[model samples]
Target: MNGVSRGTTWRMYKKHKFLFMMLLPALVYMFIFHYMPMYGITIAFKNFNFSKGIWGSDWIGLDNFERLFGTSSSFLRVLRNTLVISGMKLVIVFSGCIVLALLINEVKAKVFKRVVQNISYLPHFISWVIIGSILVEMLSLSRGVVNQVIEMFGGTPIYFLTEKYWFLFILVSSDMWQSIGWGSIIYLAAISGVDPALYESARMDGASRIRQMISITLPCIANVVAIMFILQIGNILSAGFDQIFNLYNFRVYEVADIIDTYAYRIGLSEGDFSLSTAVSLFKNVFGLILVIITNYVAKRLGHTGLW
Candidate 1:
């Protein structure tokens, strides 16, 4: 049976040899960059030594994880900030994208819709370093345009980036600005795929546009939304390192420091690779568990999930 199955698989592969050839590079890339690097995960369980290399490092069991959680309050603070920032982004930015996509779908003018989409997606292509530099200048207390306007209105200039309370707001808002348009593309595509016949039928039944949207559009796209929500849950711990790393300063570290930044600081900057790896491993394991749980819940609720 095994020999017959192997022969059948080989025959199918030969039939689509060109298609398989086209897929070869992606397979190789994943093997080299993704699968190959998975071996380094062992460093999380070792007292990783630079001089001795990954393989030669001494086995340390859970010491690195213990030190990460029990050594000080810093890790806890970092974890809190990560969750807060990521949660805010998940709730605000993700929903905003969906809303924006719906609004765009309602547009009658093709040129205007295209322009709005183009403008929205442009920022996503810009590097965080560039966006950070622009933000720093615009949010500057003394010479920023925002402060200038405040002084014009006889108001005190707010140190938005430096203040802990406001730092989180900035992170969430800036992330929305950068990503909302790009994120909406998927939703927009899903909305487009919704059968036009259903909308026509609703209109014939005297349903208003808003009513059609609620009754027809939303229900059709619920599966996509549920899948995206599950994916977001899986990434709950990764609070976008590039944006935070580029925009955050020492004064805002209390509220802005996330697990990724904490890992960079302890592992790369402070040369504690073992602890860093442990932090990463913890995040991945927890994230995977969340995905599994969320997927199960979604399936039980009669929604499509990432299987």
Candidate 2:
């Protein structure tokens, strides 16, 4: 049986040789860029030394991790910020994308739908640096358009970017704006795959457009939504580094500093490579655990999830 299976596998491989050849570059790229770099994770357990390379560094076990978590509540603060920002994005931004996708799906005018989609997608292509700069200018207390509008209504000019109270709102809203259109693309695809007959049946049952959407559209796309939600659980610790790094300043560090920015400051700025690696490892492990738990719950609830 083993011999026959091996022969069959070889024959199948030969039949799809061209397809395998086409996949070679991606395979090689993942091997080189992803798998090869995994060995560097060992640095998290070491007393990493710049003078003595990664291999020459002394293995310190969990000392790096201990130091990371023991450093005068900084790690805890950073962790809180990460969870808050990511949670907001998960709940608000994800739902916003679905709502926008549904609204777009409901539009009858083809040209208007295409234009709205195009406009929404444009912000995703813009770099965080550019968006951050634009936001800073637009939210400037003294001369920003927002402040000008507020002044016209006899209100005080509020510092949206620098103030701690408003920083999280700006971060969440900016991220949502940048991502909603791109994120909605997946839901739109899922919506398109939904059977039109379901809608037709609901309409014949005297269901209104809103009623059909609630009854037919949402249920059909529940699997896709579940999958995306499960995938997002794996990123709970990430918290959009580029966006935060580009936008946040020292004034709002208490509220805006996340794991990624904390790692950057510790690893690159302060040269504590081992501590940084330990922080990153902790995040990856925690995220992995979250994904596993969430996926299990999703499966139990009879929804599709990332395996």
Which candidate number maximizes lDDT?
1
Model 2 lDDT per residue over 9-46, tens place: 99999999999999999999999999999999999999
- Which 10-residue window of candidate 1 scores lowest in summed lDDT? 64-73
Off by over 4 Å in 2: 1-12
Write down the lDDT of every candidate, Cα atoms only: 0.94, 0.93
State the lDDT of candidate 1 residue by residue for 63-134, as single tens digits. Answer: 888888888579999999999999999999989999999999999999999999999999999999999999
Tell me the lDDT of candidate 1: 0.94
Clash pairs, candidate 1, are none
The TM-scores of all predictions, comma-separated, are: 0.96, 0.96
What TM-score would you give candidate 2 relative to the actual structure? Answer: 0.96
lDDT of 2 at 270: 94
RMSD of 1: 1.7
Model 1 per-residue lDDT at 243: 96
Supply candidate 1's per-residue lDDT for 11: 100
